[model samples]
Target: MFAALPAGASGSFGLHPQDGPHVDVRIAITDDQVTLSLTMNLVFLDELIPQRREQADLIDPPESSQTIAALLEYFASEQPLLVDGEIVEPRIEALYIDDPSPELMPLFPRTGMRGLRKIRFELIYPLSSPPDRVQFTWNSYPMSELTGGPLVIKAELTAEGILDIVEFTEQERGYTWHRTGQDIQSRMLQVPEPVVQQEDSSLLSTISIIVMAVGAIVLIAMLVSGRPAEALATLILMVILVPLFYLVGRPGNTPPTKEEARTIFDSLHANVYRSFDYVDESDIYDALSLSVDDELLEQMYATIFRGLIMQEEGGAVSRVTRLTPLNFDLENVGMLSRPTGPGLPEREALGFNVLYTWQVEGTVTHWGHSHSRTNNYTARYGVIATEQGWRISQMQPLEQDRVDDDPEFTLDEDIEL
Candidate 1:
């Protein structure tokens, strides 16, 4: 079913705002207590399901739109008894046992609910749809995605289930893509690059970012693994960004026909001997351990790539922009010090770089065949920088936090992409 948009607007791609007015809410009789299990799957305007291989890569982080906590609180306030209206809240348990279809799931689920982001339902009553005027709500309706974040909406749903979700703005424009069951599920599973993601830049930038990020995280892991001098020295130089980390881009956007996935990442192809006047062979080897091809090291062709892999001691250099590296100011440099990024300032004194980790919680949608859906991932990144000029040392500590992916009442179709 398509949501209706105004005369000419597009927030999502095509599904109008008026379609899917309330949310796919499902109530079940799992036990005596009411169980809430899923929430709306929010995506980008260009990100509705049935995505092909040419679609754009999902950018920014999942929490990039808004905090998951706020979305939950808003759902709790809409329970039937909590508001005054005549429209009846469907007794999901009765509906599930009596009949079942795609229309019965809650876009927003409440089980294992984070109390910090939820409001308690103090009572149970009946709520009428739009025409009767949803008593205490102003969120007339909710569309699936948001640009920058989400746009404010102005809509009204009638008890008959017809809705008009419009943007409450002068330049109103948004769209919604709609579908059901297996069609959407199959399309989604086939989409998205098979590789797990790491934050930073684009395709050319990705390879560099991953290598640097992992290396940095490893240093911290190394410190924990008992390499104090290397960690300490690495941390000091990186804090100052003597060397910088690098950023690349993403690979293909959607799924391809029969094929092997091919991805290209960026790197530092600088001639290191031109920047610093010090040449220490052992130090350079330790930093570029990953890039080293031992058999090729005996040859002379890998000098430029080898020398740039350092924060400690390497061939001296005469130029700065040899290869634009990712900024490694773990402290407060380069104007990119976000709380969600890693950095350290106290230990830059001894020329060592330190790795910091940014903890993030967000949602992701995998194009699941026959059923497009969304799940949450808790991720942490390791960032490192040096003191010489703030070059990035590595990006390690790459791990996804494990959390339960179910709400008490989820019926398998409420999650959005």
Candidate 2:
């Protein structure tokens, strides 16, 4: 049986805003090859290859070799990959269209229910050795007037032990990855460093002005009353006492109280988890930099991100929803030295160590369902006062235990109780 395009569709096919087609692209780089996989709705495929609109049966549809050839040709011209500043051609690995899972069928547009399906294309680009840099440009976003606006493409990249997601829009369609000293540097958004306000000095200056004015008036009145010796003594005393009062009122670097330490740690700990809210690797790093020292930024990011992954659940990254402090103990306060390069002198900074116990509620959503897990963690953190305010300089995890786990199926928005 042959499937035909929906009837009554004019110059362009329109879908409800909520039911518009979604595209996902995954790029995996290995030692010898880079594999790219793209998946989208059949509506997008039909728009790209109009001839496919008349194909027989979307499930394992019989397509002529010429059609496949045309698809490959189109990608070769539109989607290009440059490795080490040279363009590399990709070889077609697989091309097919199939019905989506029953659970996801309702998410498709109702207007094209009979003919729409899911289509996937996998391509491989060979490399002589591991690439130092790779650039991928996407120019295939559908520009049909049927689309409410430019489509959004979510791209997941896995290269050099790093995993990140980036959204490609019509305005920005290119991505570049650079290998930097055993680390991969993808597109990272720069976050401005927070400004630290200094202590107010106006109060001390005000007191000095008041003392001088009062002393000047007394000296003038004493001279007019013929008490010159007494006035001279008073003038000398004012010069000495004014400086003494100013020195007494100046603020000093006093160690934070236990209560203050607790408040500071709470904010730093929450910020660490909050960094994961961003999907972009660079954004995560940027957010973390606000609360983490530069020397520990990369290490902390990897450790926390790895801890959030649910290995039993197919390596899905869990989203942190809530954090509750269970117990906090200020361990020690002393001068800590910031790590510096060899031959550079270490700078001493005020720092404290705390043993903290906290509970985290995390959720992982996949296939229209949510799995929540609550875990308790105990760790010792080292926080130091820097030019950027207090930052986490070190961390040592002592214990971790899963407290609760629950799986719940999310109801489709279209379904009513």
User: Each prediction's TM-score against the native?
Assistant: 0.16, 0.46
Task: Report every candidate's CA lDDT.
Answer: 0.27, 0.67
RMSD of each: 28.3, 15.4
Over 38-112, each residue of candidate 2 has an lDDT whose tens digit, in order, gives 655555655556564354325334554555676677667777788899888887777655543344346544525
Once superposed on the true structure, which residue ranges of model 2 sit more than 4 Å away at CA? Answer: 1-18, 56-61, 64-67, 101-111, 114-116, 143-147, 183-315, 318-417
lDDT for 129 in candidate 2 is: 82
For model 1, how does the per-residue alpha-carbon lDDT over 1-417 read when each residue is reduced to its tens digit? 112223222212211122121122222111122232222223321121223222122212343223223333343544332222343332221110011122322322321111001111111222332122223222323332323333344332111111122223324432221212222113221222233345444654565566668669967886998989888777775554423433223322222122221100111112122211112444444333322222222232253333223222122121122122221222321222212223533232111222222111122111110111222222122112222212223232323333234453223221121
Which residue runs of candidate 1 sit more than 4 Å off their true CA positions?
1-19, 22-357, 363-388, 404-417
Look at candidate 1 and tell me the lDDT of residue 74.
42
Model 2 poorest 10 in a row by lDDT = 408-417
Best prediction by TM-score: 2
| Most accurate candidate by lDDT | 2
The lDDT, on a scale of 0 to 1, for candidate 1 is: 0.27
